[model samples]
Target: MTFAISKTASQIAPFRVMKILAQAKALQAQGRDIIHMEIGEPDFASPSCVHQAAQNAAEQGLTHYTATLGLPALREKLAQFYDGFYHAKVNAEQLVITPGSSSALQLVLTAILNPGEQVLMADPTYPCNRQFVHLLHGEVYSVPVTADSQYQLTLDHLKQHWNPQIKAVMVASPANPTGTLIEQAELLKMAQFLAQRDTYFIVDEIYQGLVYERPAESILAHQNLPQNVVVINSFSKFFGMTGWRLGWCVVPEHLIDVLDRLGQNLYLSAPTLSQYGALAVLESDALTELEQRRQIFQQRRNRLYAAMQSAGFTLKTLPQGAFYLYWDVSEYTQDSERFCAALLQQTGVAITPGTDFGKEAGKSHVRLAYTNDRIEEAVQRIQGFVEQYR
Candidate 1:
């Protein structure tokens, strides 16, 4: 007898970057020296303070499940963090802790969308976002974004795409793949527009602390954060706590109870020890250490950006934040998936294909993450690979 699979499960595409990573590991097991440039994970370890905190929690036997909404103390600390870091007035009552930002996205989408409603986002977005919408049986309306707009959605895009079926708009700042940011003024305007239409506005700020050009700001930085706005962030990228799987979000007060109930039903609670570690990292010295790591990432970004351009790659935009550089490889190959596969197989350099991000312009593009410490050597390998085609 054959088991039936739901169409939603069947239609969901695999995250191609992880597939590349798995293949790279397989090669590594055979003694191949792989230089990873594919995944968007920080190379730095979590701060000593965070480790100490987690150890203390374990020693004290604080392993039981916290509240479904997470530890009240952690929530309160995050509120203080927003107040001090972004000067954004966030009440502790408005925040909810989740296993990761991915779970936060799932919660927010589940709460807002009815079956068949739509979410409007840029075409080349974080691939999992579209999948999250699909998991909820919601539709996605992707607006094609080009380098002309810095690979971000503008108010005009929203205005043109708005339909009665569109229930929310989701976007990321210091966006994945491109590492571009939506201008603050434009973000505000879009938020106001969505608020007027009674549509939810979800902003992904998981890469907020990795910005290079200027101090990072949040949507909550606006004097009065529009009630329609929901901000999602993670400790994974900024604090080097990816393995801990801790993240939080700030939502409107009215949705707090809804999220709390959902949280109770979903996973019950986030990891208790991880929450304790997160609480420790919110302190001043830990933040300063993370800031120094950000500087190191900026240095790597600068080196890789110049080297790739010197290698005759077309980098349309100078990534302002995040560790990714999405470059056009159309000059040599239109098939980014094949290009990435060949690059990994031939040179032991792993990078993500544009197809993993979206269909529009994906075949012509590829995303290289600067998270690996051996980036200089990776650059040399990539340069040699490009020369073979040239």
Candidate 2:
């Protein structure tokens, strides 16, 4: 007998970036030269030290499974990395190393939220984040974040959106798509608002160490560990280890036991090799390599911003961190999917459509990811496409 998909699955939409990326790949497989800029992954290699660690671990035959939560050593090292970067009082017991930050978030949502419970986030944030929430049978609510809000969460927005049904607030500093960090004052305000309501406050800091605008403005810098905050981080972005799929979540001590149980039942264990690679990336000279990558992306952002502005697209918000420029394409076309698709076919430049982020997203906006292998070439191509559109 044939089975039907769950009603919940219907609510979850496909990530538009993945679809565009697939189309670009299919065209390239037929030998078309498409300037790649749709995906946000770093166009760099993991440092040699990371690879060497993986090699050493493999040589020592250390691939057997460990604690489902994570290896104690990796968890401790991750805490050390956090303590060094965030200067927060963190212990290994407050952390869980999942396969990726994505899974870590899923575990948190699953552990804390019941069916129909709502989690609040800024609209036009990350696509997969909403999907993950839906997969956990939780409702993901979007609070409209505008350029006025710096595309980050604001306390006013929270007050308007908050309710008893709301179980958590998912805030991403250096958020995906927008690449904007929440200002310090706004963060403190948000922390206070959520703290009073006794709702969960989750911070996605995967892009923490890569920040260019400010160095150490973590939410962890402002709160006690018991204040209902779970900090999510990753080896991707800053460390250039997307494929390694290693990321961690710092949970409150109360949730630690439940997460450990869920981690055991759900994930079994994170990859041993990736853990080894992450350990080296976190505690070695690999920081130098990561810093060099930041310089390259920072330069690319400057170039892309100038080029996009010259091409008639208005920079709605000059991104302070991350590698994207969220530009308003209203004058060019209201339909971002069609606009981006036409640009690719016409100029061989593939860019992500803004609609991937939220419902309000598909209209008159485009997210151009400038950190690619042919970053210079991509900008030149984007300049040509923008000129033609103008």
User: Best lDDT goes to which candidate?
Assistant: 1
Best by TM-score: 1
* Total clashes in model 1, counting residue pairs 3 or more apart in sequence or in different chains: 0
- Alpha-carbon deviation at 204 in model 1, angstroms: 0.4
Model 2 earns a TM-score of 0.95
Q: At residue 346, what lDDT does model 1 achieve?
A: 98
RMSD of each: 1.0, 1.7
Candidate 2 C-alpha lDDT tens digits along 17-74: 8888888888899899987889888888888899999999999998988788888888
Which 10 successive residues of model 1 have the least lDDT summed?
306-315
Clashes of 2: 0
lDDT per prediction?
Answer: 0.92, 0.82
TM-score of each: 0.98, 0.95
